[model samples]
Structures are given as C-alpha cells and as structure tokens.
Target: MVFDGLTETAVAGRPAWRHDASGVLFRRVPGGTYQMGLSDAEMAALSAHADASVMLDDAHRMRPIRTVTVEPFLMARHPLTVAQVRHWLPDYEDDYVDDDDAAAHLEDEWLDALLEALPFRLPSEAEWEYAARAGTTTLTWRGDEAPTEEQLLDRFGVEAEVAATENPFGLAAMGSLTERCADRYGIGYAEPAPADGPPVVRGGAADASPWQGCGEWLLALPASRGWQDMFTSIRPVI
Candidate 1:
C-alpha cells in the first residue's frame, strides 16, 4: 500500500527507499494505540478446531485481547527478499544456511540499520500481534474462518496455495511460511539454536500448507540465530 508524501514524511523521518534486488518497498507505519489480540469469534473457531489440529490446542490458541501502544516506525510493504538482504550482507550464499559465519557477517549491518531507523527494533511477540492486528480484533485478520483460495493467492502471490486465512492487515500465509511465523527475535535468516530447526523463509516463490498459515499460530524452528533454507521476507519499522 502506497502512502502520500506527507504521511510518509510523518511516519518515516526520511523518504522511503526502494531496494535494488527486490522490488519490495517500505513505508513508515506510524505507531499509535491499536487493539491487540483475537476476538471472540476467533477464539470460538480455535476452540472448535482444536481437536482436529495439534497446532490449535488451547495452550497455543489466540490469547485475550489487549490494548497496545506503539511508537512510529518503518515497516516493509512486503517481506524482505533474498536479493535485498544480500545487498546489505553478501556473504550469505545458501538460502538456508544459518551459522556463525552468516550471523557474524550480517549482524553489524542489521543492527546498524535497525538502530538508525527507530527507538524500536524488530517487533516483539506482542508488537507483531499489535501491528498485524492493525485495528481488528479477530483470530485471523480476515475473520475466524480461513480466506477463500482466491483471496489468499492475491495477498501471498505464489505462497497463497498454503495460506489458511489473511491477518487483519491483509498479511497472508503468515503461519505456513515457517520463516514468517518462526521465532520473533532473530535477525535476517538466522534462527536461534535449540529451536525445532532453522527458520523457514516466508513469501516469495514457495508453497506452504493451508493449515500452517493460520494467523493464531507460530512456525517453530530448531534455531533462532542463523539462516534457513527458506527465502526471507521483511516488514521493517522505519
């Protein structure tokens, strides 16, 4: 979604910059008070489906709704891509390799950029939920039910085939793309160690299962600090 020059200026201290590798652009998301968490319908849906999918057990189901406030920052219009990330840190060759070499190399660049951008770094678990919720109070952004196939495909592109529903901000395929929903505190392609496995990249030229794309869940991984085989998509907070 494109923003007006004035809105862009208000949100991002500077004008938006487009990355050379990926056409994906970013706009500043002005932080403000937003209701965070799932609505009653979403909770009911999760309760109804809990027995069918291990992923939806009560423990992991949507939590109580809460009011959250965020400061202004930049968020990528689309997820970060392999090509764009490489421009900043070229040492990463394998799309899924997260190791000491990759982390050490990319950390400096990532940290520098993040610090310069805003008082906030990446969205924490609560922050991501608040932003993804936009202004809604539902389980999946679209509603409790999964979105239609056509709707899913439109938002996620190739990854839509696996998306169960769209989030409040129209973010699709979040859960299925392991990379998108995995650990919330890692940088670049790295997944911290001791996770289920390396994080999977989200968005861009990949397929995920419909069940995996549910907005209420998070894709687990073995590591939290290194690269993964999947492609990366980003939503940067300016």
Candidate 2:
C-alpha cells in the first residue's frame, strides 16, 4: 500500500510504511478506545522507582484516567531524524542526527516549511499515548514491572542507536526522545488549556540527564506528559 508517496507493508502482523525518499518508516496504529492517563497505583509505583528529579505533583497533569478513542493513524517508527529533515530541506542545519543515529532537534519555524513540503504532521497528545501504549494498560508498553535502577539509568543519555526498544505495535523509540505534539498542555486533563502555556511534548529524550528537573524514567512512561523544549523532537503522523 502507498499513502503520501510512501510504500506500506505488513511486518509480522503490524502494518508499516517506508518513505523511500527520506528513509523514515511509519507504523500504523489501529483505532480503538483506551484509558489515557496514569492510575493512582501506577503513579505511586513510578514515583517510588524514579529519581529525585521526578515530583509526585507533576503526575497531576495526567490525572483522571479518562478513556480516549482514536482513529487509526500512521506514525513515524522513530522520531524525525536529521537525514529525514535534510531530505526535505537540503541545507538544513541546527541540531543534527547522523545516519539516523539520533533524533533531530527542530523548531516550529522549520515545521512550517516541512509541513508544506511533505505529508507529515505532529501527532496529537492522545494519539501519542495510544501509540506509545501499543494496546497495553501497563505503566509502559513493556509491562507494569518497576524498572531497576540500572534500567532507569540507561535512559539518561542519548546513544547513537535509535529506538532501543520496539513496542508491540512495531513503533520504535516511542520514548527514546522527547517529542513535540499537537496539543497544548494544561495543569490537568480537565482544565482548559492556557493560551500561553507550552504545547504538550511526549516521551523522554535519549540524551536526558538528571539535572533536567524531570527524571528520564518518568518522561519515558506512555502516560507521562511533558512540555516542549529546545531538545524536543518529533515523530510525524498522517
């Protein structure tokens, strides 16, 4: 199958697409309804397992575990890479990802051009969580198990290898990089979004560190919500 000039295929039951021009693979997320926030139990467990950078209060943003229904959509298997950006903007500069080794750091100014030139756009906050969960109700797509100290530390720094873990939906690196989303973030899910508040960002950057104020482990959770930053990247959806 082909959409937006990309070739699609089914790999091990999950559907995926390859943008030959940019070498970006997109995974198809099936439409369905699922709870979209952290449960009290999950919040407690995550706080216990995370470092001091994590604050119990921050979890309030993901509260009131509400059900969200999403239509099927295609999301980039990995965060947008520098190479993929260059494919659309040959003279692209700023933070770069070499040979798909890392996710590119971009600003919204670039998005204006890219969106006009390509068939991609940022995923919505709901779509992101749904895709990240990959049909799992656990704390992570991996499961509800508490992460060991070593496992939490592993997400602290960025490595050349992208998508270190693949979820059940065949999406890669869903949490490896903090990603830009299409929704504005509010104090809580029920609150109306503040006009000047930062837009919602999802996932943990592979190059995260403890000093960033938010624990890498916390940012990596599927239900975790974050705000945009200089290092925030994106995973395009269609």
Candidate 3:
C-alpha cells in the first residue's frame, strides 16, 4: 500500500511514522473494543470434527469469549525484516530480503537489547489479535466461512506460502510469522496465567519449514494462540 502522508494521518487518534535508520514503517492502529475469542459457532464446528478433537482440544482456552479493549498504538507495517535488524547488528546473516522479508531466529537477549536501543516495544497478545483482525470478527482474517476440517488442516504448513497482501490496517504478513508478544501464556481467558509461564506467540508462522506439527498450523487463524517458537519473529509496537 502507498505510504502517503494523508493516509498516515487520516484517522483521528491513529498516526504513522517511519524509522529512517532501519527503514521500518509504523502504522497507527485505531484502538477499540472487540470480542477476543472464538464465537459459539466456531466452537461448535471444531468440536464436531471428531478426528481433529485431539489437535484442537486446547482451543477451548480461547473460550468464555470476552470483550477486550485495546488503546490506539503504533504497530510495524510489516514484520521486522532481516535487513532492519542488520541496522543494529551489521554482521547478521540471513537469506531473506533486507527490507521486504521478515526476520526470524531472534533470541530473547537480542530482543531485549533491540528494545533498549529502539523506540519500540513488543505488542501484547490482545493488541496483536486486535491488529490482525483489523475490525473483522471472522474465523480467519480472510473470511468468516467456517473452514472445513480438510481446509484448515491442509491450508497451512511447510508447503504453504504466506500471503503478501495487507490486512485492513494496511499491515502485511499477519498470518505469516509466529510473532512473539509480551503476555504470559495462559490456560484460558477466565483462568489466570502462571507467573512462570512461557511468553505468548501469535500469528502462526506457517512458512517455518522445520516445524512439522499439525496444531501450529491452526494458529494461522486470527483468534488462535500458541507459545513462542525457537525461531519466532517480532512485530514491534510503539
């Protein structure tokens, strides 16, 4: 999408900015409240599939569907590409494009240092879901049609390609990478998260060729959740 000044400031509270040094563009997301979990119909559809029950059993954790409010904040227009990370770590090496492709294999210490040096912070899980949905209440940001068992299972994997198109917010790759977030992993929305829990990860990285699991593919849905991966990427917030 075009990064014109008019588009950047069109929204009342939302605004956009560009980090010249790293060439990372930030888009302002207009904040509002949204239902943060699976709808009744979605639950019913998944439960009806006997074979997928084992793979999707934990899907209940997204339940007790709650209305969550998110305040307006800036989010990276694209995942932090390897090229941008190289601005801070010049010697970094990767096959992905410097400006266009998402960065991966980031360690926690590196993220901490990057946050310390930059004006950005990691987004919360709620904020990530809100941005991914971009105002749509659907099974996937792509649509509301409940996916057939075969469709959901075969749609994403090592063989699948992450679409380059943007969501309504003009953000790209919302379903591409398993992005690390700031929230602790929890059992369910109604249950409290253990203090020692692993960090939450969202926006399933279906392109990760090394991950051969069936469950992670379901995370491609906007409402689906998962834990951080050894090769998770970052989509910073400001």
Candidate 4:
C-alpha cells in the first residue's frame, strides 16, 4: 500500500557519492500520536498464551503502553545496510565487535556529504514503531496472529532485503528486523533515558525465532554495544 504521509525534503540526488550501497530512500511520516508499546490488555493476553511463547518477565519492561506524539521526520525506507553504514564509517561492520570501533575510522568527506545530503540520524524506538505501524493496531503489520521465524525468513530472507511491497505506510522491513535505534537501552515511556547503556532496538529480527515477524524488541546490553549482527540495524530519520 502507498503511504500518503511523508515530507518533501528527503535526500534527493548525488549518485557519485554512493558506492556498493543502494542509495538510501526515506519516507516522510506525518506527525501524530500512536500507542508506543504493548498495552495492559495485550500484556495480559501474552501472559496467558498456551505455549509460553511470550514470557511475562521478558515483556514486563515494555509495559504501560503510552500514547506517543512524534514530530514529522523522514524515516529510512529499509534497515540501514552494511554498505550504507560503511559509507559513513569505513571501519564499521554489522557485528558485535567493539562499539568504540563503530565509528572510529570515518571518512571526513563522507560525513560532510551525508550531513549535507540530509539530516541523517537513528530513529528513536517511539518514532520507529510509529512509522512501522503506519496506522495499524495489530500483532503483525498484515496479520491477526503473531508471526514465526520461518515466516520472517520466507518473506524477508537474510540481509533484510529491501521490500518489494511495503506495509500500509510504505515502510519496509519493519517486521523483518529488530531495528537498532538511537535511544539508550532500558529506556521506556515510564522512565528517562539512562546516561549510558546499550541502545534499544525495535522491530523483530529475522532468524530471531518468534521475535522475528512479530513485534518484539531487544535491549542491547552494554556487553553487546556496536553489535549490528543480522538482527541489529539502524533506521535513520531526520
């Protein structure tokens, strides 16, 4: 489905700057309010799932779904690719390596060009979920039941392919990746962001069993910083 919400100012041109990576595309999501996390009712239902697929303790941190109001921003159309990320920080890789190295080796020209091209930055979990939902209030983007890992693989595959058909909002890979964002880990609507912590990641990750294809998120422990393995990736927004 085509999304009507987006801004007029996405990064437009400059083909020579990009190499190996497909040029990033962003969707302008109109500002509005939406439920940011699991609701009390939804949590209760998960507690009662017959197979214990949704653990209560594991989900407790995401409780108290709050109505989040976001400002208009252009969200990346796909999970940030390795090539795309490498373009900015040459030494970066989507791995659990030292996060200090995540951006240690950077090309000044690429950085300047990126800033000039657009206001590129990672999306917060709130913004990420808002764009991912696009307007739906269901378990999966297009389903009534929770999705499975196999489902995620069958649909998106490894590397999180750029979606051919987008969600209702025209956003891609929302369910296929446990998208890493800019917020400090352990942050929630009920509390303030910590001074230092592993960044929170949104959307389910491919190969992450049940979590993939479903709306479960992960909080990167400090031990796992700079880790953007198959399950971790950034979705830039302005």
Give each model's whole-structure lDDT. Answer: 0.39, 0.71, 0.66, 0.51
Best by TM-score: 2
Model 2's alpha-carbon lDDT is 0.71
Error of 2 at 64 (Å): 1.8
Candidate 1 lDDT at 198 equals 44
The residue-level lDDT of candidate 4 at 165 comes to: 29
Task: State the local distance difference test value for candidate 3.
Answer: 0.66
Which is the leading candidate under lDDT?
2
In model 4, which residue pairs have backbone atoms overlapping below 3 Å? Answer: 6-28, 7-28, 177-204
- Candidate 1: deviation at residue 221, Å? 18
Please provide, for model 3 over 132-151, each residue's C-alpha lDDT reduced to its tens digit, 9 standing for 90 to 100. 89998765666744332333
Please, what's the RMSD in Å of model 4? 8.4
Error of 3 at 132 (Å): 0.8
Better of 2 and 3 by TM-score: 2
lDDT of 2 by residue, 1-238 (tens): 4586788775545677888778777887899998888877676666555462353666677887888999998888777777677788787775444444446777767756665776678898899999989988777777766433234322212532333456888777676577888888787788778878887988763546443434555667888887876556768998
Candidate 2 — which residues are off by over 4 angstroms? Answer: 1-4, 10-14, 50-53, 96-100, 146-164, 209-214
TM-score computed on alpha carbons, candidate 1: 0.50
Candidate 4 lDDT, tens digit per residue, 68-117? 89998766656555556555656554343234312111223543444355
Of 3 and 4, the candidate ranking higher by lDDT: 3
**Compared with the true structure, what per-residue lDDT tens digits does model 1 show for residues 1-238?**
3433223222122354353343444444456786544444454565665432543343222334456687765455444444445555454343343432121112344534533542323444444555555555554445555434343321333333323343434333333232333343233222333455443332221223344445323232111112345334344444
Off by over 4 Å in 3: 1-16, 45-55, 94-100, 145-164, 208-216
RMSD of each: 9.6, 4.0, 6.1, 8.4
Give residue 19's lDDT in candidate 4 (0 to 100). 18
